[model samples]
Target: MPSDPNRKIDIECDVAVIGAGTAGLAAERSARRAGARTLLIDDRFAGTTCASVGCMPSKLLIAAANVAHGIHGAPQFGIHADKVTIDGKAVMNRVRTLRDEFVSSARESIEDLPDGAKLKGKAKFINRDRLEVAGKIVHARSVVIATGSSPSIPETFDGMNNILTNETVFELDDLPSSLAVIGAGPLGLELAQAFSRLGVEVIVFDEGDAVAALKDEDIARTLRGLLEREFAIHLGVKVRASQTGQTIELAWSGESDGKKRFTHVLVAAGRLPNLQDLNLASAGLDLDEHGTPAFDRRTMQCGQSSIFLAGDCDADVPVLHEASAEGAIAGNNAARHPDIRPSKRSTPLAITFTDPPSASIGAPASEDTIVGVADFSDQGRAKVEAKNAGMIRIYADETGKLTGAAMAAPQGEHLAHLVAWAIEDGLTAMQLLDKPFYHPTYEEGLRSALRQICSQSQVSFGPDRDEGSVPGV
Candidate 1:
């Protein structure tokens, strides 16, 4: 007899991937390419965090703030302009419009998949190799868990209103009269500065004294000083919030304690993975004290089982590039199951999108590594741009391999990439110095820092000496 049309059915595939976010999409594609019948599942077909409400929208807001900032600072260059006005509604409208385009592009990839290969529903593990999606059963030889993550609201924020996370902040119809940003991390500080520049009365509060997780003391101090010039930052304290009518009252206790009220509070503390509904216990994997399963980060595998974990689920590195790399690794491994491929992760690189910007690359320095310093306060390019408030430190091992570096410098994003590439390629400071260094450029600051490491390591600059180069010589 034929099966009833109203009844659910069981389906089988070589691989089942949970979540269709950035990492999940990559995993599904990679698994299919490896000759596996793959199934991709998501709670909803929303675009990636980067395109939907994270990087793209945040950058759009920053771009608008930068234009207003430039106009305000034009007088320093002896340039004058009439009164500048920022239409908050128009700015947010453009952000949402362009952001939707990016999200639509990401959605196209999943839409192109066969209807049977994609399912729109939450996936729960019935067993090690079985997932129950809606009423249908999906049995797979291997499974990849890449559910991504979501904004983590504190317990104190429960039942609270007018609180904004990175995901919800971009949806605002217009800028608020005031914003209280809770956290001095990258996300918090970036938005705090952007909103301040765009005429929002902003105050940042953080339990930690430092900004953006920088390890270097000097760089952090320099960055904090520069930022303080723009707005207030209260650190070394825990802030409690209470709603009062249309305002949110924030109270903090520390060296300097005070209470301030704002129209809204932005919680940029961090993000947590979405795993509550997965019913992980059914997988029967050995779980950690935190309930996370033990897995090899390099292979993205969970113990000896065919199940794999990737992306923000591991919470090891939450950056987009790291997510993509981990997704590919997990996908290929899930497709090949009992025989996983060798995986080599690249050097770590991170950037904070501040006005002058800040970046960190590779690992932090140990006592044995020599350090090189550059003060962009005297940098020609920075002075010319009127953004001379910056510093950089380069770390190299005794053998001169560029191990790590930290910077609160202008164009540090580009500098961090160069340093990361050099570290990844095992290029020593002197070897990198052998390359060209343009005059009157921000990269010259990098050369300055590299020279210090080379000098400390007794490595000589052969030819094309940066200092010897003269214009029109």
Candidate 2:
């Protein structure tokens, strides 16, 4: 038999995964485990975003900054340090080293796969069931898109020389003398505090009224005020930016209006899904108002088709854990297409790493909801450590079941998890109060709020009225 002239490959796979980020790796692994001939494809072969730039690298920098901040605040405990300094080079060296280790671990997973099960170029859909990668052709029963997202930069600020996004900020030789951060979201606020505490004059700007995307007006107000004392932050107004010479000038129109030039500007405004290179039109997927493919959130199925979408590309919940869970759903379902089964998503939870970290779980309770609040200033443990600041709010239904909670308190991350578990288990505020809370601990603060909630919730379990919802995440 003679070979066909148009044939580029004899590849036939049960699943084809695009991109090699956290979600893509998960999908490929899951599909392969399900006895499918999965072909993993990636352009750069980089690892998870958290390990590379999003979480680990940023937290490493925050850890160093917090150490410097702790030494400066030692006088509160009647302990004075003669001198404190942060070695910028040393700080970055550690971040890069640990980050590389994570990337290397991810590479090992790819290396374990057979050579025929992986592809090393960009893939574009040639038709409904076939893809053209580089110059080769592949036929797959189902496709999983996990290309992830990239930093979103405003068009007006394009082609500027002094602009640095999260993608490029960590590569700097040393911290900038002065830095201006755009966007007061989680990523922006985290980096702003890190830079400011490390001796960089940092200012943050965001048009939104809230910080860290907090919906509870009470918590948002308190957290914003606390963060303001730590560094200069301007919110609730548009920011004007331009480049001149070797620096960038930032200006905002508001009560705190001023134009200042900075050595570099970090843009954490938002992230855009990485779908442009895939030529989505060839796949013939149904598009929504934004020209994005319409898909079921629970099933990850695109327009009742075999193709699945996952991770940051869907922009549903961009957190790392959420990405992994979504990947598993898309992967497993793709292995058995046309028989999609909806999977229940866990109770929504989000946290922003700051001095007194901000956290939110589930959604706000209904109109008949009873709210409980705990002020850290009055808490025993907080006062003893001089970290007494911020507030925690818990919302319960009339039957005393915990619907959601929000906090900008010390150790809010741990508190958020405890609340999430209660919500997941359908435990009422009264039931949570039944559990013992140790003395003088931050968890006690949570119990304080739960007690307040139980006080207002006297009715028995009943039918629903309002479906609580979370915003901006």
lDDT of each: 0.87, 0.85
Per-residue C-alpha lDDT of model 1 across residues 1-473, encoded as one tens digit per residue: 32233344488899999988888988998899999999999888898888998888899889999999999999999999999988999989999999999999999998999779988788888788888887788889999999988888888777888899998999999999999998888899899999999999999998888798788888888888998999999989888889988898889899569998999999998888788889898898887776677899889999999999988887788888998888899999999989987699999998889877888889898889899898888788788898887889999988777999999988888988989999999999988878787777888887777778887885666665654433321
Instruction: Pick the TM-score winner.
Output: 1
TM-scores for every candidate against the unseen true structure: 0.95, 0.94
Clashing pairs in 2: none
* The best candidate in terms of lDDT: 1
Residue 458, model 2: lDDT of: 87
Worst ten in a row by lDDT for model 2? 464-473
Give the per-residue Cα lDDT of candidate 1 at 136. 85
lDDT of 2 by residue, 272-372 (tens): 88888787888899977655678888988899788999999997889998889889889988988877889999999999999899988998756887898
